[model samples]
Each structure stands twice: as C-alpha cells, then as structure tokens.
Target: MTLLIENASLIMSVQDNGRFGFMRFGLPESGPMDWRAFNHANRLVDNPPDNACLEIGFTDASLRVEKDALLAVCGAGYQISLKGRKMPMWMSFWAKKGDLLDFEKTPGGNWAYLAASGGICSQVWMGSRSVYAIGGLGRLLQRGDRILIGKSIHRSRWDAGWFIPQENRPAYDIDISAGVVPGPQYEWFTDEAQTAFWQQKFNVTSRSDRMGYRLRGENLTHRTGADLLSQGMVMGEIQVPPDGQPIVMMPDHPTTGGYTSIGTVCRADLSLIAQAQPGISEISFIEINLNDARDKLTKTIEDIDKIEKPQEDVWTQL
Candidate 1:
C-alpha cells in the first residue's frame, strides 16, 4: 500500500528511534523531536515502538490513502480531520482507499507525529530510516511523493480505536523545566554564571534547529580565560560560547565542539526541549545528579510500559 502526500506547507520527513552507533563517524542521531508522542502514535496503530513515522513540523499537510489502512496522530497544538470529519488525536482510526487525512496549523508546539500501521517504508541509512537532511540521509518529503506502507501485522485488528490516557500526554503550553547534570567542563564556568544558569529563565531563539537551540539570557562567564581543546559533543550538551549565550545541542548536533559546556540536559528531558517552539518557549534547568537522572529515566520507561499494556478492559480501553 502507499500514502501520497497532497500538500505540505512545511518540512515533513521520516524519523524513527534515530540513527545510533554512528556518531563517531560524524552522524548525529536524527529521530522524532517528540519521542513520547511518536511512540504513542505507533502504539495506537500497533506498530513497533520504534517504527518510522512522519514528523510534521509547523505547517499544514495532507495525505491520501491509496488502500485501506490504520493510522494515528499524536502531539500537541494540532487538529486532524478525515474527509472533513474531525478525528481525535492520540488515537488510532481506520481510513479507506482515497480517504484524506488533513492536519491543521499548530498553535502551541512546533512538531507532531503521524503513524501508520506497520510503518513507513524508506531506505535505511547507517541502520536508521531517519531523515538527516543535512547528512544526505533523506530529503524532506514533498507534495506528490509516494510513501510506501509496509505490511502491518495489526491491519486485521483495525476495527476499533486505541488512545493514550490524557494524563500521560506532555503539555507544551506551560514553561518547561528540564533536568540537567554537570558537564565535563562544569567547573570551568564562574560561580556567578553557574548560579545564573539555574536561576534565570531562557527564551529559545529563532536560530534553533536540529543542530542546536540558541537561548537568549544572561551571559555565562568562564573563570579561566584559557581555551581548551575541542572535545566530543553529544545531544543535550549545553555549550556556552565566548559571548556567554548557551546553545543546547540537539539530535543532529556535531560530533565535537570547542565551546565550554556547563551542563548537559538529562536524557529524559531531551524530548521536552525538542518540542519547545522556537521564539515562543521558555526554559529553565534543574540540576540533578547522575544517579537521580538514571532513576528518572527508568521510571519513565516503566510508565511507558504501563501505557502500552494497561490492565483495563482491552475492548473498551480507548
């Protein structure tokens, strides 16, 4: 089966759990900006949790189903419709041949996820189907593009719908407090700078992208004026340049950098930063220890498992 893109006002591309184990070769893991929503969308359609889905950003888009299929949409700030009838998000529904799926403008968040039964069929690059446009991995989807749909094991079970509990969804309208752990060069930053980082609120700038988010706030000063050798960079590393403005690296960030990093966002909060809309979102950091960060991640995983296999009535769960 195939899905045809009718219109896309902004960039939409394929993303999965991201390209892994190849960052040493200069490739950053490119995956869904909102992992929770992405995972929920897939689960609604009975796809593997890591199956590739459409990561829609900013604008309107429409798709036409060429065959009977099951699909789901999850994320904030967008409304969906099927053939002019309203369709609820964070839930799975069936569409027949020639059915149209429409996504309206997002008013709160910048990204959303759309998942189909089975998964999107695309060429894998370095063990991932994610579109790292800058790395020449995959291109932004365009109108008239034919997206092949893989054979879904749950296709026969599409008679009913599935939904994520309202309490489990992440909210983007409010200020986000991301958890952070000290970076390798945390001590290099001046005491005042360190204090300001945790005390002040930072606004995400328009220059933000998959590479990093440039925050506008008080400058962070380094105690030592000496320049250190460039070191390996990773996603969520909060690097402060000579100007003092911090740039929080993202999934498509470079493999290494020379800027001093005062801290790194905890792995669990990476998705929070990803969903932050540039120029609109405000962020703050809460310092945490490595052990606490690991524990939080474990708890998040456990919560997700419960969402996927709730003990409630299976037939009336949604």
Candidate 2:
C-alpha cells in the first residue's frame, strides 16, 4: 500500500510512541503532541499501540491512496474527506485505491493523527519514528510525496464489537486542571505567589506549538531574587522566564533551560495541555504526590488498553 501527498499545509515525518532512555544524553522526548489520540488511531487500525502515525499540525493536509487501505483519524477535529465524501472524525473506515484524503485547518485541538492499517512506513531512528523538529532529524511532510505502507494483517472488516464507544473518545477543553508538583526552584517563590499560581487563570498565547506553551497570566516573581545555572529540563516542566510568566514545555522541548521552574505538570494532564487550542482560557493546577501521579498514569494506560483490544465477538465476525 502507498499514500501520495496530494496537498497539505504541513505533515511531519513518522511520529510513533517516542524516543526513550536517552534523556541522559541531553535528548528530549519528541513524540506525539496528543499521545492519547496517537495511540487511539493505531488501536482503531488494529496496529500495535506504539505503531507509527502521521502527526499533523494546524493547517491543510491532503493525500491519495495508492492501494486499498484501512485508516482512522483522532485528535483535533479537522476538515477530512475521502473521495469527495466527508470522513468522520474519531472513527475507523476504509479507503480504496485512487481515493483522495483531505484535511483542512484544525477546528479544536492543536494536532491530529492519521493511522493506517499496520502503520506508516518510515525509517526508524533511536528506537522511534517521532520527528524531532529541532534536532534536524525527523521533519514535517511535503507535497507530491509517496509514502510506503506497512503490511497490514487485519485487512478484513470492522465489527461493532471492536468499535470505540462515544464516551470513550477524548475531548478538547480549555480549563487545564493539571496536577502540579513543586520543582527545585519552588522554594524561591513566596507562599503568596504559589497560592496565586494555583488560584489564578492564565490565557494561552498565540506563540504556542509542539515546542512549549506560553501563558499570559499574573506576573509571578521569585522570592529569593537569585539566579541559577542552566540545568536539565523535562517535558511538562513549567519554567518562569525573566518576564515572570510561566511557560509549560511540551514534547519537542529543549534539553536544558536557564529559567526558574516553580513546578512541573503531571503526566496525566500533559495531554490536556497538548490539546489546548489557541485563545483557550487558562488552566489551574493541583498538587499531587509522586505515587498518586504514578497511579493515575497507570489507570489511564489501562483505560487506553481497553480501547486497543478487539472484542471477542467482533474478531470472530471479522
């Protein structure tokens, strides 16, 4: 199977689960902006949970099928059509050879994922297919590009038993109520600032993307008035620049930073930030213990797993 990039504003190279165990080498995890949707798209196509999928950003994207294929889309609801017929978002469907797939501007979230049966064929680097935009490694897609398709084992049909229920689908929201934990520089902030951080709401600025999200909120000042050396940073780390606004780092974040980080966003709520559309309202934070954070993430994985496996009856029908 193959996919021809007929027209698209921007499409990134293969972005799978992510590159892991290399943060020590000063590398950041460059994966799906909305991992929940990436995994969901793969599940819909009967591919492995971590299979590679197309991570599309806010803009027009179009493609043509070179062979029969099963496909699905998830995340920000964008304009999608197959052969002049409107393609439903968050549902698995089939496309025949010569079918044209088109995607317009994103109406909801910041990114979208397009997963085919098996997965998109691309060269893997560092144990992942995720494009590292800054690393000069993986990259955005281009027009007139013919992409290879992996061999699909489940090419038969879809059964209702394997369908994802409406309630199970992920939704887009603005009030990002994410779990926050005190950072190394948390002591530098006064109790008042800390309280304000959680109580006050901040608006997401237009200067946001896969790299980091900048917020326009109350000026958060440090208590100690001290400067610290540049240190390692992680995804979801909220750093306060000299201007006093907190910036939440995302998937394609840098390895190090010089700003003071007052807190870090919990893994469970990272997706909430990832799905935030520009002009969305500010989000509040609640502190949680490390063990609680782990449990919450574990439970989320279990819920996603439920969506991956095909129902017994559904498989039999296929």
lDDT of each: 0.82, 0.78
Model 1 whole-model lDDT (C-alpha atoms): 0.82
The alpha-carbon deviation from the true structure for residue 195 of candidate 2, after best TM-score superposition, in angstroms, is: 1.3
What is the TM-score (0 to 1) of candidate 2? 0.90
Residue 201 of model 2 has an lDDT of 82
For residues 68-113, write the lDDT of model 1, one tens digit per residue.
Answer: 8888898876788889887778877778899999999766777779
Q: List the residue pairs that clash in candidate 1.
A: none
Clashing pairs in 2: 9-60, 11-141
Worst 10 residues of 1 by lDDT: 309-318
Give the TM-score of each candidate: 0.92, 0.90
| lDDT score for residue 26 of model 2 | 74
Give the runs in model 2 whose Cα sits over 4 Å from its true position. 158-162, 308-318
- Expressed as tens digits, the lDDT of each residue in 234-297 for candidate 2 is 9989999878888899887888888799889878778877877667655778888889888978
Q: Tell me the spans in candidate 1 whose CA falls farther than 4 Å from its real position.
A: 156-158, 308-318
lDDT score, candidate 1, position 2: 93
